[model samples]
Target: MFIQFLKENRYVSMLLTLLRFYLGWQWLTAGWGKISSGKFDASGFMYGAVKNMSGEHPAVQPWWGNFLKEVALPYVDFFNVIVPWGEFLVGLGLILGIFTSFSILMGLTMNFAYMFSGTTSTNPLMVLLGMFILVAGINAGKIGLDRWTIPFLRRLLFKKTEKEQFPQSA
Candidate 1:
């Protein structure tokens, strides 16, 4: 099946590596830009999203807008810190393939948040590419650090306990 091919195919993994690099670069640069600027703020953006809930066809739904106004706006300081750092970390993870699936999921989450806020930009395209990387799963990161980290983590987490390993005469 197509899903199997995406998950298991070496060629698909190779292609995914390329896409991962592209997405990673985009995120790193965007985050770096904000971080370096030292003036990144989400309050204005949140306010705009809330305002966008009006008009003939609202770009942002009232429910999301209300959440933004009530929850997000009140927590603008937190958003200001996390947005840039989260983007940077996601980008780094994607580029290094250290935690490819988690990185892609985080990136997708940010993309969806941006879209929900009515800032389309390249978020949709990034989401599409990210979904492919997600479907490809471990294979997508096989060529990178996940090659060793995943197996190591798996063994560490799943290793048998002392009782299980040394169960004897009872």
Candidate 2:
């Protein structure tokens, strides 16, 4: 029932758009800080993530921690480039409502990854908002560019040519 309301109502969509803006701002600032830095690095964060494995109630699963240390740490330099730009792009996508669900999904994925690394800052709140927006589906972006963009893309990419082949009857 609530989901239906969110899908159909304008007020709910407006509220979700506000949430999207807030979340987008958070992502944009975080990424912009890293990108603007002369030499942004993820080695420290990766090291800390690996270190989380030692605690009794480790934030990361042992297997996942091992993967991070063995696989991720080795490529910290690459992550250093990817993470910042990815965050900025995700923020831009969400703020513009271009593929909003995809943006929310990516944001939620990052939020979960942060939680798994034991950094419990605003990640949980962001996750909740991302989930809410995801559940809202197409309506979530109705107030943003998706208003026209989605429909246009759908018509172009998923256009039903067969349906249009039928001529009008007299």
Candidate 3:
């Protein structure tokens, strides 16, 4: 039934596009603020975060945490420096619509981390937003740089694919 609605309403596509762009812009702006504030600090913070998260969820702790603890934490400064930049890049990617799907997934990954860390309330909005972005797929690129960049991006990322054209609905 919902599928029929999705098929019938052309505005559903527009809603999805607007939602993705707005959410992406919001995320990018927030992350950019953090980066520009010059107070970015994730050293022991992220390590502690990752450890606490793993300890809290014993059943789901990936083996990679051990590697993160051993190899990654040793260079805490590097992680601290990069985390905000990574956030900014992912946010920029989404906001700019460069890699809409991948950026949405990255945003979801970060949101999931926050959600799992006993911060579900604040994360819910973004999490739902991520879900919508994912369900909407690549059709959410009309009002962003992705519309112009995706052609070049497709050549670089999906050079062998013939299905990299823009959506008909747009």
Candidate 4:
């Protein structure tokens, strides 16, 4: 069944590979641009934006936004410092087809977060992108290092099912 699925849906794989690669590359490039801007500072930008909006009308009040001001502000500030680097890493991982699923998962997490905190126009697009990443399952493991390592790691880290142990022996 799995082999048939792959053989029949190979075009789907190609489409997803293209989509994931371009999106990932775009994200990484954006992060690189931010880092190279010299004036770019995550903490300063996020905190300044938050401080500027503390009592003003916010587009949305994602639960964490309030916590951001109350308890997470400092961490938010700290995150700002690292976010560009994180974006770059995630993007690089996805584009290189290494840890493809993991990278998409991370990207989806960020997109979902954005979807909740912004105006409807931007939010829906991000939400759609996240859904695409999830549904496409574009791991591309066979074409990359993840193929060589992740299966072994999974076996070491997780319990094998009876089916996995027995396979045709069942």
Candidate 5:
């Protein structure tokens, strides 16, 4: 019942639109800040995360810390490029309601990654809100571009018109 309401309710959709805007702005600002700074470095952060695995009840888990040290540190340059741009793109997607599900998923991925690195900040809240948007599915983007894009894509990909899918009553 609750899930159906979330998925189909017009009022809930409006609330989701507001939530999307808020999250989009948060991501856009954070990404823009990093991009404009021209000195966003992940190596230091990686080192800190790796070091965090040492203490008892370490903030960062050993597996994640190892991944950070071994994979991420070696590819710090890649992270440097992808992190800011990924955030920016996710924000843009969410705001535009194009690829809304993908945007939320990417945002959640980043949020989890940050949390794993021991940086809580606003990540938890973002994750909670993001989950709501994700669960809402297509309804979350109904007021945005997905209203058209999804249907167009469905027609293009499935090669089925709505009339065929739902025959009109004579």
Candidate 6:
């Protein structure tokens, strides 16, 4: 019910777009700063994430801790490139609405990743906004590039081919 309303309503969608833009801007600036500074390495952060793991009310999950210890920590160089570029791309997608839903999904995934690493900060709020945007569906992107790109991509990917597959008698 509420989802339907959010999806179908123009004003609601506009509001959602604003939120989307905000998230996009956030990602863009963060990534751009990293790229420009040439010092946005994730190695130190990853090390700290592992070191921060504690008892009882631990911030980081043990499973994530294991992954960090086993995979991420050993591959700081790889993560350094991936993180900044990933943030930049996500921000571009969200801002342009070229792949709005997919962009939001990616953002949500990153939020989860950050949270799992024990860094809360704005992740919770971003996740909430991302969820709402996801719930709003195409409406969230009706005002942006997705409005055209999505339909075009859909037709390109799923066009009816029965007529082309078989000759119909006139």
Ranking by lDDT: 1, 5, 2, 6, 3, 4
C-alpha RMSD (angstroms) for model 1: 1.2
Per-prediction TM-score: 0.96, 0.91, 0.66, 0.68, 0.92, 0.92
Task: Record all residue pairs in model 1 with backbone atoms less than 3 Å apart, i.e. clashing.
Answer: none
Q: Per-residue CA lDDT of candidate 2, range 10-76, in tens?
A: 9999999999999999998898998999488878887888888887788877887887899888988
On lDDT, the stronger of 2 and 3 is 2
Error at 117, model 5, angstroms = 0.8
In model 3, the Cα lDDT at residue 35 comes to 81
- Model 2 residue runs over 4 Å out of place are 162-170
What is the per-residue lDDT of model 6 for residues 44-129, given as tens digits with 9 covering 90 to 100?
77777777677888788778888989998888888888888888888998888778888889889889989888788999999999
Best-fitting candidate, scored by lDDT? 1
lDDT of 6 at 86: 82
Q: What C-alpha lDDT do the candidate models reach, one value each?
A: 0.94, 0.88, 0.66, 0.61, 0.93, 0.87
Cand. 4 TM to true fold: 0.68
Question: Can you write out model 1's per-residue Cα lDDT over 1-170, one digit (the tens) per residue?
Answer: 99899899998888989999999999999999999999999999999999999999999999999999999999899999999999999999999988999999999999999999999999999999999999889999988899999999999999999899999887
| Higher-lDDT candidate of 3 and 5 | 5
Candidate 3, overall lDDT? 0.66
Q: Flag clash pairs in model 5.
A: none
What lDDT does candidate 2 reach at residue 129? 84
TM-score of 5: 0.92
